[model samples]
Target: MTVSVLVPSSLTREAEDKREATRKLGYVARAAAVFRVDRLVVFPDSGAEGRWGDGFVETVLRYAATPPYLRKEAWGKRDELEYAGVLPPLRVASRTGSGSDDSGSLRQGIVTEVGSDGRVRVNCGLQHPISLPEPDEGLTEGERVSIRVSSRRPVRAKFVDESPPGFVVEASDLSTELSRDDAGVRIATSRHGEQLSVDRLGDIVADTAPRGTTVAFGAPERGLPEILGVAPPGGDEGGAETERERTDLPADEPDGSRFDLWLNAVPNQGSEVVRTEEAMFAVLACLSLTE
Candidate 1:
């Protein structure tokens, strides 16, 4: 399934310092990798941001998502990545079957310099930048592209038309991402949504696996209900249940709602508040069980 994960840019607002914030995003990146997310979108939540703000959040996340070999070339020195050292390594899984590591594999690279002739210099995590002919679509400096590496001893590689391993990172507006034609089953995760149970697993997997799914999450303490200004389930009562609660929302049928389901993926949450990274694992672990 084509999974898309959305996190508010104010995700690190509750962190005590840059190190803490950067570390938190590390786990978030790990969650994306573990779940094989296709796109990790950072939606704007500027009003609730801290001193780091969205810029810091975006920069660090982008840096973390970059493959280790291409990192130095892709992202040079940046004030926003001061605490990037705290980020945990994201060991994105390998592709099996036909394009397995045994055979030639595709790797993501950043164009260091575009040549005037018909070639461009790319840093694909080799000893040095290599030269290759530009694609029919052409290439630009700083543009990321996929390269097929056949042999490392002789350094045989070429640019190819395909996505490399690992999830992509980008920033976007919540509405726009949710509105995408391929957004699949949109889910908003909160502590006050429908509780998920084993009985419902079959239906959810059958429904979302084929169509793909897009899941949105909020910052620490700021649940999806608060982010979208929607009252949590039973908000009028003593309070909404701290479990997997849900609401009906269909992408094709946008009933003035931001998501197709307001899902409390983690039911009977023992912790008073689940960090965004923790929530990602708890929520996605269940969703990942799809064909």
Candidate 2:
């Protein structure tokens, strides 16, 4: 099952500094890798942008998502990744066959050169770029491709039709992502949305797993309702209410617009504030489970 996770560019709005922001983004990347997300979209939230806007968020996420072997060549020195040292390792294991077998392991490669002789030079973090037979339609210079490496000693590898081991980072408009054709079971997560229950989660996973799903999350203090200008449940009421009361949301119809199902991933909570990264783990733990 394919899963696409959409996070606002203002995700680090609550961060106290650049270092802290980078650390927070690391966990977000960790969640994506843990859940095997196909896409990690950083949607624009111009109004709520801070010292770190779309550029910073996108750059850091892209850097974090890049495989360790290709990082140096894929992304050169950049100001946005100043605190990249603190980012946690994702450790997304290779899904290709194991043992000393000919099936080979999957590795990400960058096309350094495309030749007229139906061959292309790929840099898959080897000692040097290697040239392999061109793909059916041919590949372009600078295009990222996957290679299946059977023998590293003699360097036997071939281009393969597949994605790398980690989630791909993307920057997109919020509206554009919501309208995609493959955007199956669009879910908006919020404290004021419907409360998530054990029974409900099983149904959601079973139903949506086959078709794929897209889930959107809001930044701290600024939720999807606030971002979309849709009134939040309890309607600007005071914050002294309990979690049970906050999750006592209205019926499931997108909370008026945009989403297919509105959800309160954590129904009961002792902490009044739930950070975006925290909520991500809480929500995805239930959603991405397989039988």
Candidate 3:
């Protein structure tokens, strides 16, 4: 099953400095990798956006998602990646295999050149770029592709019709992300949402496992209801009145109703505040549990 995680661009809003912010994003990346998340999306959170914006969040997440070897090729020099060194290692499964010939390990490759002879030059984390015939039509240079190496001694490999091993990063608004056709079982996590009981979690996982899952998170200080301009449950009497002044949130639907489920995954919180990175680990750990 495919799992997508959505985090607000203002995730690091509470960070004391860029170094701390980068470190926080590192843990977030590590959590996503540990949970085998397929996609990590950065949604806009203008209200809570601090010094860093979407570009910084996307840059760090994209860099963290990229394999250590492919990082130089995928991204060169960027001003936004100042503290990338602090990002934790994902140690993705695909990167752990022995590079021996018969390992049949899948590796990510960048199409360096597409020749007229139906052959393409791919740099698949090898000592040198290898030229292999196109496995399918419409291959182009700079396009990322997956390949499996059968023999590394003689450099034998084939393009595979599969996604590469790591999760991809994307930046978009919450509405657009949730509206995607493949965004199955959209869940919004917040402290004020319905408390997730053991009985309810089983049903949630069972229903979400087959079709895929897309889980959204809020910022450091801002919750989903605040970001979406939806009044929280048992909010103040003027909550709706205040929310209506901010955005065009529909009056009929309850606050955060756009999501299939609004879960208070961390009920009885120990701390007064939960950091975004910390929440990612806690929530994904519970939701990813399999029977």
Best-fitting candidate, scored by lDDT: 2
Q: TM-score: which is higher, 1 or 2?
A: 1
Name the better of 1 and 3 by TM-score. 1
Backbone-clash count (model 3): 0
- What lDDT score belongs to each candidate, Candidate 1 first? 0.80, 0.83, 0.80
**Candidate 3 TM-score over all chains jointly:** 0.86
How many clashes show up per model?
8, 0, 0
What's the distance in Å from true for residue 124, model 3?
1.4
Q: Judged by lDDT against the true structure, how good is candidate 2? A: 0.83
What's the ranking of the predictions by TM-score, best on top?
Answer: 1, 2, 3
The digit string of per-residue lDDT tens for model 1 on 1-291 reads 689999998899988888888899999999999888999999888788877684777788889999988777778888888878888999875542355443576788888888889899998888888888888898889998888877788887877667888888889988889888899998878777667788776777777898999999999878777777656765523233421233422335344346666677778879888889999999899988844
Q: If scored against the real structure, what TM-score would every candidate get?
A: 0.89, 0.87, 0.86
| Candidate 2: stretches off by over 4 Å | 97-102, 115-118, 233-257
- Model 2, backbone clash pairs (residues 3+ apart or across chains), number: 0
lDDT preference between candidates 1 and 2, better one = 2
